[model samples]
Target: MPKVVLLFTGKRKSGKDYVVSKLKEMLKPEDCSIIRLSAPLKKQYSIEHNLDYDRLLDSSPYKEAHRLQMIQWGERKRESDPGYFCRLATEEEDKPVWLVSDCRRLSDVEYFKSHCSTGPAHPSCVLVRVSASDEVRRSRGWGWVGGVDDGPSECALDEVSCDYHVINNGIDEQLDMKLKELKNFIEYNNNG
Candidate 1:
């Protein structure tokens, strides 16, 4: 049982969590474990800052001002010590497919690729990018502060590329279709 890690990022309320939840339902919890890298950091930050964890994590101010640095530091920490994300992935011990949601840095992807590339325990990973308008995201109380400039900046585009791009413009049906297509692709390749 190899793994399928779904890497994604977008403004808060852009359906990253909702979409991942839907995928989990479709795939079943036994077959997959959806994990986020920033989740722990978000918890710690919230505790230190006295902010709601959900709101702080979804806030645009957090993303715009600190996500990059936090992600970079996380990557360095992981490199120096390999068990950071790996431990979380293996904690459940069910060998369920690991859906690594909220994978933001190139180093994060690189770590997974290096560790899960071989053996029966190997992971079949698929990178997915979720996108949506800031207005839509903000209205949902996602805390998008950057306004219209929230789309991936040029640096982001160059830094991270996805195997699949899903524009989450508020159509549940369409999102289902995209996730289905990704599932089909993963199944096809893994079988082959």
Candidate 2:
């Protein structure tokens, strides 16, 4: 069967992990497997930077500043490699449905475009974006107080351009509804 990957993104504490976990539960063991790409980068970075993994994960720089470091390192490791995230996603060929959490940039989108197979005849790819107000995001544990257009400053301006947008305003029930909608959307569009 062709694979279906749900590419999700949001600012830190925008409930990206929570939403992805919800989808994992909804999809179940047989329906899909949830794969997180940032884990590998987090681990490697923790080791190199001498920072606690859990502590660094919640840091805004972890996604922005460290992501650049990771990309540069990955480029040296392999000249066309899109970094550890894409590499990991490609390794998960056995799963029919994949929930790809934490997509961050246009490069990440293009990496998925090149790595994922999508068509009317195949399972396809679904890109869903999650967002929240700066207040809500900060309240939910977003590391940085100010949003930035680039680099490690918590909020990135381009997140609105993702394929599907979900506003996570810190309400669990609302988040659930949006995720359910996403699940239905994917099934409906990829059923062929």
Candidate 3:
């Protein structure tokens, strides 16, 4: 178990990765590392579809072209095992602080709450909701897809409880303040 598990959820292109990237720069390497719940999904999907996993992980046309299908495939996988990707993402992490960068559904949050938070290490698990305007997301390359934008994967945690609510609009004053608040949470929770 980690000293803190910072679980983050946000809509597509809401700057979830960007916020965590900023956190990575703020925190020392030995103190924190990012874990993406989508990494395992993309790895498996690439194998099944004979696609390059590297390309799938990149921000290229190939990834955008298959984003919807990959989302559907991941949904099916989650239906069978809600914690599959969540487990894969964290099982190997030994850092004292884990920034889980892509928590989409409520189950993702629940998984950490049930497993990591209760271990002998007594990890501090907390939800963080990252938000940005739809216009900002569109500008960041997230065009609306009828089924996915309407689906459970995107909407499951829209109203869920969170310890921090951050508005990431390109690292403005508001974002800096919110990030400091989050750092306070981590600084309080970190083991050393």
- Of 1 and 3, which scores higher on TM-score? 3
TM-score of 3: 0.92
lDDT of 2 by residue, 76-97 (tens): 5434555556676557556667
Off by over 4 Å in 3: 118-123
Error of 1 at 78 (Å): 6.1
Clashing residue pairs in candidate 2 (N, C-alpha, C atoms within 3 angstroms): none
Model 1, range 81-183, lDDT digits (tens) per residue? 6556655545554543666767655656666666655544434665677787778876776553342234332134334667788888888788889989877
Please give, for residues 1-192, the per-residue lDDT of candidate 3 as tens digits: 788889999898899998998877878788898999889999999999999999988777798789889989998998999999998887788998899998988889888888768554544888899999988998888888887887877898988988789998676889888888888878877944
lDDT of each: 0.62, 0.65, 0.86
- The count of residue-pair clashes in candidate 2 stands at 0
Q: TM-score for every candidate vs. truth? A: 0.67, 0.73, 0.92
Q: Which numbered prediction scores highest in lDDT against the true structure?
A: 3
lDDT of 1 at 82: 51
RMSD of each: 5.0, 4.2, 2.2
